[model samples]
Target: MILEQAILNIKPEESIVFEKAFAEAQKIISSMPGFVNLDLLKCIEETDKYLLLVKWESIEDHTIGFRQSEKYNEWKQLLHHFYDPFPVVEHYETVISI
Candidate 1:
């Protein structure tokens, strides 16, 4: 599996709206091919920060499958605006799991 991670820095005072938008947008992502699951977590120390973790069957499932699809436009409209400077997303493969 491939792990997608991002530290979302939301614009000041926009957390609530962002959360609602993300809740709506996640439905789009969940319907994509190769999507496994997702987790969105709020940072305890940073009120406007969120951590997004998504599992996919492969990196192409995200980079090409999702990003290249028309659904991405809807997803972007919903959640992209709330980002401060925009989040940097990265992918990883498991090194170890016990």
Candidate 2:
């Protein structure tokens, strides 16, 4: 499995709205091909910060399949504007898991 992670810095005071929007946006991603699952985490110290983790079958499933699909546009519309400076997404493969 491929793990996709992004550190999202939402606009100040917009966390609540962002979370609500994400609830709807999650449906879009969950329906995509190669999607395994996802988790959205909020930071205790920084209320405006969030961590989005998604599991996919392969990198191409995200980079090509999702990003290049029309559904990505919907995803972007629903949640991208909440990001302050935009998030940098990275992918990982598990080296060890217990």
C-alpha lDDT of residue 89 in model 2: 99
Query: Model 1 clash tally?
Result: 0
Per-residue lDDT over 1-98 for candidate 2, one digit per residue giving the tens place of the 0 to 100 score: 99999999999999999999999999999999999999999999998999999999999999999999999999999999999889999999999999
lDDT of 1: 0.97
lDDT of each: 0.97, 0.97
- The global Cα lDDT (0 to 1) of model 2 is 0.97
TM-score of each: 0.98, 0.98
Clash pairs (backbone) in predicted model 2: none
Model 2 TM-score is 0.98
